[model samples]
Target: MSHAPTTLQERPTPAPAVATTSLSSRTLPRWAPLGFAAVAIVLGVGLGLVAGWHSRIQWGLLSALFFVAISYTVTTAVENKRQAKDRLATSVVWVCFVLAVVPLASLTWTTLSRGAKVVDGYFLTHSMAGVLGTEPGGGVYHALVGTLEQVGIATAISAPIGLLTAVYLVEYGKGALARAVTFFVDVMTGIPSIVAGLFILSIMLMAELKPSGLMGSLALTILMIPVVVRSTEEMLKLVPNELREASLALGIPKWRTILKVVLPTAIGGITTGVMLAIARIAGETAPIMLLVFGSQLINTNPFEGAQSSLPFYIWEQYKIGSEASYDRAWGAALVLIAFVMILNLVARGIARWKAPKTGR
Candidate 1:
């Protein structure tokens, strides 16, 4: 038996190893996005040509469709169903983003191209008082002065009142009075800019007063107050109750706590909101047209004489029906856009600079 067992070891044989294939292990290459973009462009152009659609809009739509379809098909072939679906969703979001950006980019490009032709130093510094609409040497100096004064006055009138109202609503409001205030604020928010102008115009007429920058400012203030109040209320509401309670727990009065703890915390948002309101009212042509009465000469004193703003200037120039006037209108539009953009940037900067500190 021992001799037979020793010879039996060579009789057995081993099985071969089995290999596995998993779709999850497969993935698209790093260059896939670039390749997909190039292919989409070609397909989009071809489709546009074949369909006799000459517009960029049609080509863009086709390109987006092709990109999404091709991405899904390729991803599904290479990977599993779940990964392919994920890629499809991502492509859709990217396409939406591109669509949103294209119009804004086109607008900016068009404005810059047309505005650059007439925006010179001389155009910015001289008044159109002596020069005719057909002439090219006049500038926006008079309208610029009127706009600055009127807007400054409006801000001065609205900011304090709006802030106080917001503070009351957030910190001390209750019952019927609060509800009434809120209701009126909502109503005022929806009032037409032209209606605000008319309201002021009616009052001015009752007083036998003529159109002036002060009257324009009164209308702007009417429009701006609701915006400021709404924005400030939202900002103030964002201040944590815990912070207010902590101050009160230290024996501080509610008013003092609001001043010391709440206002500082929300100051950045408050300032930004105020600036936004000012920017909004800056381009209102209706109020300026009704109340300011479009001045051709510089009027530094807002309360005394007729005035003009950037918006009114643009309208006046366009209505003049001359090449020089049209050029000036475009230039004025560019300046107005630049001014608004600057305000927005400044607001963003202030918001970032004064954002709440969180130690990590």
Candidate 2:
């Protein structure tokens, strides 16, 4: 009866479990990378100066190395090992990107600076006809015209053949014949530009043909076809089989389906590939040298006589080794670069315009 007055004691509850670490606590601040880069640059420059290095390239390389090392070390100290490893990978990638870009920037700047001395309205509008290499009065008009003609002819010849060949490979390819064609295309892709020129030269010799823009066009066509085939084949392969099946189920002819449904779906990539092929052939110096036979006059006719192209013109000018010729060479080079860039830009535009529209 006396034990009835005993009371129960309250037990203490366990504390709620909390995380030991958080993303914000484990990661470096946003400004950390910039600060690390600044410190690395200063140290790299200081070391380069102390070591009596003159090349800015050396400074840049050293800075990159220091940046990667400093980032990894700092990250290790402030965070865990895993985050430090990730930061190290990111730093290396950034360094590689800068290294790749710096050379391109330097080359573009050098070309622009030297090329501007001679690239003017007169330079673009006139030709090297009746002008001495030692003098600075000629222009790239003749070369530009020849380049356009030859490349145009080559494109006209190669595009249809390559596109058709790619279609056959993707749509109806099934046999030893297809395999043989694929093998040859692959072989042609690696064939040297010089080899292509030599092959065309052999044909010219057999036919008693003279060197002209037409001859250059033939050589360029050889180089261009393989590129177009490879690129178009890849693009066509990317088209979904479901669309093809649906088209077939609708009782459409296979060729018509490919022409209407498959080609339109991949037209963007196809056009882009063709443009890339054109650009590849556009810069070929060997073919131009072996076939075009470089003209100094403004021979607008590509098939009749020797004609100049930008690559041949640049080579001829540089070989002259005069200040004026060097300027002309640089100017011609600048023009060629501009031409290629325009082609690429056009390709981008065409690709975007032709890309399949998807409803959201």
Question: lDDT of all the models against the reference?
Answer: 0.91, 0.93
Error of 2 at 164 (Å): 1.0
Which 10-residue span in candidate 1 carries the lowest summed lDDT? 1-10
Write one digit per residue (lDDT tens) for candidate 2, span 53-167.
9889899989999999999999998897899999999999999899899889989999999998999999999998899999879899999999999999999999999999999
Overall local distance difference test of candidate 2 = 0.93
Candidate No. with top TM-score: 2
Candidate 2 wrong stretches, greater than 4 Å: 1-24
lDDT of 1: 0.91
TM-score, structure 1 vs. true? 0.87
* lDDT, residue 260, candidate 1: 85
